[model samples]
Target: MSRTPSFEPYEGPAGGWGSARSLGNILRREGVPASGTLVLGRQNKVDGFQCVSCAWVKPAKPLPFEFCENGAKATAWEITSHRCEPAFFAKHTVSELLGWDDYHLEQVGRLTHPMRYDAASDKYVPVSWGKAVREIGQTLRALPDRRNVVFYSSGRTSNEASYLYGLFARLYGNNNLPDSSNMCHETTSVALPPAIGVPVGTVALDDFAKTDCILFFGQNPGSNSPRMLHPMQEAAERGVPIIAYNPLRERGLERFTNPQSPTEMLTHHETKLASQYHQVKAGGDLAALTGICLAVLEMEDHAKQARLPPVLDHDFIDTHTHGFGDFLGWLRTQGWAELERRSGLSRSAMTATAEVYARSKATIGIYGMGLTQHRAGVETVQMLVNLLLMRGNIGRDGAGICPVRGHSNVQGQRTVGITEKPELVPMDRLAKQYGFEPPRETGLNTVEACEKILAREVPAFIMLGGNFVRAIPDRGQMEPAWREIGLTVNIATKLNRSQLVPGRISYILPVLGRIEQDVQNGPQSTSMEDSTGCIHGSRGVRKPASPHLISETRLVCEIAEATLESNPLTPWKDWASDYRLIRKSIGETYPEIFFDYDQRMWEPGGFQRPLPARHREWKTENGKANFITPKGLAEDKDMPEPDEDALRLITLRSNDQFNTTVYGYTDRFRGIRGTRDVVLMNRSDIARLGLSEGDRIGLRTASKRDDVRRELGGLTVVPYDIPAGCIGAYYPEANVLLPIWHYAEGSKTPAAKSVPVHVYRGPAAA
Candidate 1:
């Protein structure tokens, strides 16, 4: 058994509208005077920052208060008055700080300077920016091969920086880009390109405005992506059907009391968000989606005999799609009994959903990690596309696939070429445009990189910004694998647990945050991509928080210079100081898409990257969109049952937190105050286990042949209306129960949502 971590239980606000008020309260309670407070304005305009929470596309025109509850907390957390100056570091050693919880380590405030971990002194001492970059370059030079280096891009990176970073990595002679998306929506990336000839969302923000009905599958927009609530509110008010399907009954999906609208807030009025909510099983999404499609197919057959309009888009299928006969055959073989058992939805419920979908002129399907994080996640999304295509929903004003991303620029990063595998055309074109041959050999993804770290194959690690160590699945295995790497360099705005993983020689270099000014040696602006595939400019107005801080663009360039040594790749000699040359290179490489990127960005906001959906065009290999099929219903491996008393546990994020970092502890949405110890369980499950609502339980991983045992103890079980046979707990803490090898069958994304175990009583649970 792995040793239990010695730390306080995490207690944070459940991410939502009330989180903003809670954060403001915490700041005041902590004696950070209100007058000194800096409340950044709403998102979508100047002074308005991107919500640090989830990715909900910003409206073209700002709302009364564009910021949502979690977004407000994210802004306040970033603009907090708290600071972790040099004196604070002097008071605590790295070992001492290691004793602190993840929340305490970050809550102390932002780092003030470049720092290196001094092993002898056991504290992080400030280092100069020049020296820090030089050290990173030196480490890279020492690596036996360029392939030994792994470059990770977080979703938080702006488009311009991501472009520059990708260019630098390719120029440095490697394509080991294991990005944040791999951990979240790689399923969409892998499945979409094959199904639709695109790897990103096909829908745009304007498309939502035209959509008559939106089918939300396995998503919790209210807490996961609150900004979606605004669009959902608009659709709901317009009498559009918004059907939601998920195992858990998220309060955000039921109704939203918009804090942005004063009228609703003042009168305690709430807008009914979901037209119908279906409680599907944890891994039953694919069954539910297919069942809906089957219903539609049946309707289409009946309509044809009645001499009514063909329910299936015969014109679309014949002209712009393929594989219809094969898909139809598969649907015909599926029985209602099998569908109902796999989907956990009653036939009446399925019929209700099909009625909304069949009646709608055009419908939009939106899903989140709940669908994409599973073994059949990719196929589940493709099934939704199949249903939409039955009615010719693609290449229309109000339709297409919309995978709600968690990080802000996840989709953007993929668009700008942050990937382990780049297509031959893009790579060959890049080589032709840039003077160097791009690497042909595909590189490692998130799962592969973790294995490489464990095998001690990757010699160096460079992270733009992400709490990787904590964010990855299987904490016990990940921590040890992280320690085996030769070097780990982090370009960050603040220190995270990843910094202390002890990669032979490690450095945490401070950089400017998005809300801060980014002035190169010359005047230049940076570009970023939004969730909807819109590429725009991001200009930081405020000064860098500290004098020593540098922009990530300059730092990555310098590291490239240091690592390449005497054989520098291109005109990178001055690229660090001049960002326009970088933009110019990006345009040259992707001319058809990023044409005149520099000039176009100068206009109001920026320009949208063109897509076939926007112009109703299909760019598939067969000259038409394809109907894809799944090998199976789902892919989570069933574990052997433990003793009757044991329970399986899964982890999730709270409202006051993003990934692993905590801003404060108070889950207002669940009505639990000052605690992360509360476990969400079905009332029936509680009864079945002979446990009361407030009973304490110990969660243990089912025994395996490998002898790797995980137990998370001292959890307070609070009966919730969650789907039966499933449980929800906060992450990093519960991450221990997830096995590294227990991930998606093809995508390799850790199944953080469905780990099977035994929940029982006592300190043994801990």
Candidate 2:
């Protein structure tokens, strides 16, 4: 609301002057350290700290500036010299700071001390790490049940820290390990294991270069994972057909001018990324994918009729997969007209897209949260896997499924046993190695954890990192739920809204950033698993903002040492002293995946964690890939058919934003500037609703749920190229409109992608 937003066409492709401008803005705000020169070229390559933002993989070799625009911003942000010490907190009270926007709160600068809130003065003051740990431990000990406490890990945390946190939680008799993964990729974890063997993606970065065809399903790489754009650009240059399916035509998926290319950087030459674009309506991915599959099936049937070679990989299907015949029968039940009706694409378009997949010997499918953050997000993911399996895309060079995960180590956190439910976490091995019986029962996820907190079942809420409040839906209740928590401990690099919405007893634990020297276990580096499963070492080159800062691993161990004093076998101090011991413990527990963990990280190219699914092996109940067939592609069963005046609201991230971290108000790709409270609606829809471009509107959730009165007022509507009946708004701000109970039933991921809303008048048109 600072400036009335202005709209213009974003003419240039992604990674042009716009990105450079964004990067400059970050550097100017967060005074870059002297060690930036050392970090610039080495960030994502071998022996460098992974970008703390997205989980995009690193190249084998290094780039002069190895990071993308946002990655560079994140790097500078973490390495800034600005400090938010006791004096800063003394000036700004929790209530006063809560009124400030997310960007300003973060811009206030890095948290440089472990400060506990003194309710008497309504201020946070410096506290010793020992005292902080003791207070947290005492609170944990005092809990009526260990389930009353929750341990939430962010994707930004290191594998060592997450592993130790998981261990500590189980040892403390609480397996309530809610994490950032539950918010973003829980669908992948739930859907993939049944469809394929692994919950994580199977593709490596090299697969992009070797594949002849790739399908970008509901992914905006330029904004979320800019590094992935390079591979897509290269794949396009090779004449490989790159098809994109999304409700919004994201510039990242449309075209990319690689800033890494000196030629393109100077000449302004651009590479068109998507060969063919399919603009499906919101929550129509399952339908779109089903249409493509239907077309493929039709092609196979035609091939048989014409006495030609089989179009489908019958051999692979017969050998490695199960339930194909049943899948085919289910496909027969669904008609092309229905699929096309729901998908918002023509039959010819779907057929042409299917043809590309049928002809290509090696093809890869890359998807993101757009497909996953739905009512049937897990099924949507499984549908993508089904399409790939039809052609035997798994376990082959240049062909696999790639879930372009957001956050640096979101996938890594899960791999290192951060999930509430047991995956590859060897409980027997942990019991033998650490002399404790780890709980095998399912624990809380991001949504479940919040629900428990709201119900007053959870007393202490602990987050390793991330702005949980802004990121989660149902903030109408969630905000209050966070307030009700008895104890809240947040280990963070910068100030976020979640810190302000604290419990009765809250502490802000400032910790070392990825660019800060973490000399706890010697001058060592932390490792993160990229989206493609490449584990690489990250060593911070800059000095800490404050000497009082602690490492997340050390912090977790200290709390565990204090809390689990009765457990003699848990060597918290020993693990804290040397991070290698923690990794050794991890390797011992998860030998098949994290084998030779310490030595593997030191090796060149680090290591590619093995994917058993890549070998065409399934870990399903029957030990074979299962084709799950939903009755129809439509996701929201509870969603009522919108009135002609109603709109399907899909939450989005601007080019300047990642998750809840807002860099600027401008969304250059959408051609909007100087405001965050804006909506993108179809031109036809704007006309139908009698709302002209730039008209202010308020959104009311059109749900049957009586208790949910979520609304966001004063949003400027900007008519764009989106499909009719669907509208777009920025996330966290729009998260208010999404109900608490409205989430993916299978995975419990907030269905931020689709929320039926009634648009009403707000203020007057400018």
TM-score, each model?
Answer: 0.93, 0.97
lDDT of 1 at 763: 53
**Model 2 C-alpha lDDT per residue in residues 1-766, reported as the tens digit of each score:** 2666788978889998778777777777777634554566667766667788898877777666878988887887777767787899989888898888888888877898899988887778889888999998888887777765788888999999999998888887767888888887888888898888788899987788899999988889888888788778888888999999988988998888877677887998988989999888888888888888899999999999999999899889988888898889988778888887777888898898999999999999999988989998888888888899899999889999999889898888888788788645777788898887778777888888877877977888888998888888888778887887889998898999999888899999988888778897588678888887888888877778888888888889888887885666678888887888888888887887788888788665569888888887787789887778876677687877666977889899998888899887888888988888888999988888888988889888888766567788888888788988899999888898888778987899989998999988984321
Q: Please, what are the lDDT tens digits per residue for candidate 1 over residues 1-766? A: 1222222322222223354466567556444435314434434553334554566666556665666666655555555566777777677887667666777777777667888877777777788878888878776777668885899988888666787788778877788888888888888877777677777778878877899989988777666677777777788889988999987777777777666566766676677878899988777789998899888888888998998987777988887788898999999988888788777788778878998899988888888888787767778878888888888888788988888888877877777788888672388877767667788788888888887887878888889998888788777777877777878887776667888776777788878777666677755557666678766565555555687778888787777777663543356656677777778877777787788877775444346787775454666677678898777664454555323454435467765677676766655566555667667888788998988877878787775545777777888888776777778888877877777776666677776766777876875543
Using lDDT, give the best candidate's number: 2
Instruction: Record all residue pairs in model 2 with backbone atoms less than 3 Å apart, i.e. clashing.
Output: none
- Model 1: how far is 446 from its true place, Å? 0.7
| Candidate 1, run of 10 with poorest lDDT | 1-10
